[model samples]
Target: MSDKITFTLHELVSELDAQADELLKARHGITGSQFIALATLADVEPTDITDLARCLGVTKAAVSKRVPSLVKAGWVTTTHPPGQGRRVLLELTDSARDLVERAGRDLDEQFAALVDHPDASGIDLSALNDHLNTLTAIFRQKGPRA
Candidate 1:
């Protein structure tokens, strides 16, 4: 692709991410980061903040900050796992499952629509995800700047 096309791809991703953050806040009263933490917990095995950070390819501090918001939103609860030596186990609440399911459907619909639209039709969904994964890996290896 040309330089302009590649730049458009990057720009589109960033735009979509901002829009997603707004959508989450409007519909769920939570930020994209918080929703992501909850979604990870809902899908992944019961885990602590550290494991969740690793799973999301984000930092522990990032996940830690979101945990309190999720807890306040009634989407999560944290506790000490049995014999885990103070390891804090996180659980998704019943409300969280409902919220995730509802938001998941909305997000899925929004994504499908975006991908199907003429502006985004050139990119394959799987290819986009693969490229995003590569970007995530690179970021993890190098880390982000302040």
Candidate 2:
């Protein structure tokens, strides 16, 4: 490979995301977005719909649409905060937790295989992760203009 960077950071990220999403969907029967939302909910005790939307990098409208389907599937539920008006918080149900756990195992196996590949010479994952973090911070700060 040439020393010159042929792909922009954004382009490389998009490509990786596409590949991961395709693989995850094919293997697990879950869309990338759904998996992300479910995973996020798995951590927090509960989250507001708006908060979940932000975490998922999607609009509240999109979250609204997705929540219903997740609710129908018995993977999530809405809870009202104590003494609060009917504004509801989102949370992953038991089934959602199990689903996310399975997905995590699958991702771990795939990641381990790549990291252990014999041909992965000169690959510095820690450094790459740091660089990507910087790039992501810069782009998030700049928004669409980035």
All models: lDDT? 0.81, 0.79
Candidate 2 lDDT tens digits, 70-141: 999889998888987767798888888988999877875676578678898777777877997898799788
Task: List model 1 lDDT by residue over 108-136, tens digit each.
Answer: 67887888888876878878789888987
Model 2 error, position 14 (Å):
2.9
Backbone clash pairs for candidate 2 read none
Clashes of 1: 0
TM-score result, candidate 1: 0.73
Error of 2 at 89 (Å): 0.6
